[model samples]
Target: MMPLSIYFLAPSLDLACFLAKLYICCCIKYVVVLRSYSLCLFVFLLQPVEKLKKMDLSYSEHLIQIPNLCGAINLESINLQGCISLVQIPSCFKNLDKLELLDLSDCENLKDGMENLPLNIRELKLCRTAIEVLPSSVRFLLGLLDLDMSGCNKLKDGIENLPSNLKELRLCGTAIQVVPSSIGCLMGLSHLDLYNCEKLESLPKSIWTLKSLEWLDLSNCPNLIELEDCTSSSLRYLKISGCTGLRSIIALPPSLTCLDANNCTSLEEISSWWTPTVQDYDPQVQHQNNKSEGEIYNFEQCLKLGHDTCINVIEDGARRRILSALDVYLYLYLFLSLRKI
Candidate 1:
C-alpha cells in the first residue's frame, strides 16, 4: 500500500480541506466589518441636534412651554398647530432674525403677545386662536404673503388695516357684518376665503377694484342679499351657497370660470334675461386638483320667473359636477341634463 501511496486521492483530499478553511476565514472577517459599521451608525443616531433649524412641536398638547430659542440662530420655521393650552411663545423669540414662517393655528389659550414678530415673517397662521383683536403692528410686515384668522368667532371688526403685500386673506366664521374699506389697499390680494360667515351682511364697495382678485368664497352667508359688479380681470371662482335672502345675480365679471349658488331657493334671476355665456373649457379633462367647491343648485324658481330668455341650469350643473365631483352631484347633473332636453 505504501508503494503507490494512492497519490492522486491523497493530494485531492488535502486541497479540499485547505479551501474549506479559507472560506470560513473570509466569512468571519466580513461579519466583523459589518458589526463595526453598525456601531458607527448607532453612535451617529444618538448624537444631539442642538443646532436645529426648523422646530415643529405640533400636536404637543401636554408640552406647556419651550426654552429660549435665541440659541437656534438659523431657525426659520416654527409650527405649534393644535397645541390647545399653549398661552404664548417665549418673549426672546424676537431674536429669531432668520424666522420666516410661524403657525399657531387652533391654539385656544393664545390671546395676544404676537404684536412684535420677526419682520422677515412671510406667512402667519393664527386660525381658531382665542385672540379677538389683531395687533396694530401687523401693518408693518411688508413681506407678509398670507394671513389666516378663520374660525376666530369673537373677531368682529378688528381688521381695519392689513399688510399691503398680502396675497391671500382668510376670515371665515369671524362674524363681521362689514368688511374694512382699507382691504382695497392690498393690490396683490388674489385669493379670499369667507366661507360660513353667517353674520356678514355687506361687502366694501372698494372690493371690486382689486385687479388681482381671482377667487372669492362667500358660501353659507345667509344674510348676503346682493353682490356688486366684479370687474376684476383675473376673477374666476365664486361661491354663494345658502344665500336664501338673495333674489338675483347681476353684473358678474366675464372672467368667471366657476360659480356655485346651490340651495338659493329665493334666487329668482341672473343678469335679468340671462343666457349662459359659453366659456372655453377642457371638456375631456376635469379639475381633479380643486377642493370640494361648486355645489349644484335647483334653478326651478328662476325658470318660473317667466323671463323671455334664460340659461339652462342643467348645462351649468353638469359641468360643475363633472369638474368638482361633489357628493351625489354627478347623478343629479345627468338626470337634470336629460330632463331639460
Candidate 2:
C-alpha cells in the first residue's frame, strides 16, 4: 500500500490546519517540508504524533516557529538546518526520548532552549549558530558521539562539560580562548578539529594524553605561542599551519606520521625526540598506526628554524625509517618524502 504524505504549499491557514489533522489519522511516519515558503508549519498538529519517525524542514527560509513536538515520542531524526528565521527550539524537545540525530546548523538567531534537548541524541550539528554557551545539561547526553559547533563566534565556554564518550568534536572558527583540562575525559575521542580559531591562546596539557585521538587540526590559530611536550598519545596527523605567533614545537607523539607547519613565521625550536623525554619512550608506541604506511613533515617557509634544528627533524625521520621533507623558502630538501596534505 502507498503511504500518505503532505507537502506544504501556499495554502490558507485553515487548510493547513485541516491537512495537519488529516495526516495524523493516516499513521504517517515521515514528514518533510522542503523549501517551505510558509511562515509557520504544523507538522505536529498541536497533539501527539506517535508514529512520526523523521521530520525534515531543511531550507525552510520563512519558518519562524518550531512547532511543539512534545508528543513525538518515536521521532528519530529532525533536520531544521538553514532555518534562518527560527529563533529557538521548543522546550518540549526534551520529551523525544528516541531522537538520535538533530541538525540545526545555520540557525543564526537561535539563542535558547538548548538545555531542553533530548538525551538520546548521537549526532548534533549546530554549525554557524548564535548560541553563546553550551548549557551544563549537555553532559547528560551519554549517547552523543559527534558534535560540531564550528563558527560559533559568540561561544566563550561550556566545552568542559562535553560527554566523555564523544568520538568527534569540531570547534572550528570559534572564539574559545582555552581548552579546559577536563578535555582528557573524552577517552574514546578520535577526531578533534579546531581549525582557524584565531582567538584560541592555549590548550590544556591533557590534550596530549588522549590515547584514542588520531586527527587534530590547529591550523591558523595565530594567537597560540607554543606546543608543549607530548607524553603518551596516539595522535597521527597534526597541523599547525599559519601559526605566526608559535615559537617552538617541543615534542610530538611516536605514532604521528604527518606534521604540517607551513608559514609559521616565528617558529624557532623543535625537539628531536618524538616523545616528551627519551625515558618515556615505549616500543609499542610505533605500533599505533592511522591506516597509513608512510610519513610527511612539512616545514615550508619556516626560515627561523636553525640549521641544526632542521637536521634533527630529518635525522629523527631517518631513524624511524620514514621519509622527510623540509622547505626553507624556495629551497626544498626531500629524502624519499611524499607531501600529503
Candidate 3:
C-alpha cells in the first residue's frame, strides 16, 4: 500500500513538481504544511485530490495562498489557524460543499474574499482576524451552528445578517455598539457571548424574545445603561459583571437560575421581581419545586443597589430557607407517623 498522508516541513521551489508527481496516486487523505516561515508558498495542485479529508497549514506565517480545492469533493476540515500572512480565501473555496469546519483564527491580515464560503459549513472560527465587516452572504449558511469572531476589534457591523441556525456565537472584545432588532431571527441560538464589548450601549428589545437562548454574557460593557422589558422563557444563566454604566434592570427570564451582576457600580434599580417567586410550601410537592433549584446570585460591589431591591433579594432568600426547613420537618413528621401506625 502507498502512503496516503503528506507532510511538507520545508517546501522549496521544486515542491510543486514533487506534489505533481504525488498527485497521480490520487488517494492522498491528509496534508500538513507546518511553519514554512520564509517562503510565500502557493500550492496549486495539478490534479484533483479526490480523497483528501483534512488540510492543516497552521502557523505557516509566510504562506499567502492555498491551492484551488475545487476538486476536493470529500474534504471536511481545513485548519488555517495562525496563518497570519494569508490575505484572502481562494474563490473556489465555495465549491467544497462537503466542508464542515474551517478555522481562520489569528489570521490577522485576512480582510476580504469571505463572501463565498461553503454552504454546508458547520463551524467557522475567525477569532482575531482583520475583518471589518462580515459579508452579507454569511446569512445564507443555513447549516452553520457555531461561529467565533471574538477579538475582532474592527468589527462594528450590525449582526442582522448572521445565519439563523447558529447555536453558539462569540463576539467578545469587539467594537460593536448595538445588537440590532433583527437578532430575534436567531431563534435557535443557545449561547451568545458579547463580553467586554465596550462600545455596546444597548440591546434590542427583540433579544429577550429568543426562546432557545440559555446563556448570555454582557460583561464589561461599560456603555450599556439599562435592561428593560425582558420576557425570555428559556434563559438559564446571565452575566453582567463590570458594567459600570448599567443603572436599571427591569425584568429577567422565568427560567433563569444563575445571575452574576458583580461590580455594576451604577446599578440602582433591580426589577421588583428579580428573584423567583416563592410559593407556598406543599408537603406533597418536592422541596426542589419550592424555589429555583440550584440557584446562584451575585451582587458584589453593587453599592448603588436600591434599598427596596436589597430587601426584596433578602426576603426571597429568607423565604426559601424557611421553606426548606419546613420541608425537612414535614418529612420527619411523616416518617414518625408511619412508624406509629
What lDDT is reached at residue 119 by model 3? 90
**Per-residue error (Å), model 1, residue 40:** 31
Ranked candidates (TM-score, high to low)? 2, 3, 1
Query: lDDT rank, highest first?
Result: 3, 2, 1
lDDT digits (tens) for residues 1-341 of candidate 1: 12211111111233234324533433211110000101111111111123455655565565456555555666677777877767775575677777788888988887777765776788889889887777677788888898998998888856876788999999998868888889888899999998888888888878878878878899888888888756433466777877777766655654455667767666766653212222322222234224335433334333323233235443444454453333343544554465567
Candidate 2, 1-341: lDDT as tens digits: 43565443232345355546655556433443322334354332434556667777676666777667776777888888888877888888888999999999999888777888888889999999999888899999999999999998888889888998899999999989999999999999999999999999998899999988989999999999999887367788899999999998887776677889899989999854752233443445544442367678888988897878766676665544432222222112232233321
RMSD of 2: 7.2
The residue-by-residue lDDT of candidate 3 on 240-328, one tens digit each, is: 99999999998765455577999999999876563332332334332433445566778899999976786565455444444445545
| Candidate 2, superposed: residue stretches over 4 Å from native | 1-47, 275-291, 321-341
Per-residue lDDT for 69 in model 3?
79
Residue pairs whose backbone atoms clash in candidate 1: none
TM, every model: 0.67, 0.82, 0.79
lDDT for model 3: 0.77
Which ten residues in a row are the worst by lDDT in model 2?
323-332
lDDT winner between candidates 2 and 3: 3
Clashing pairs for model 2 are none
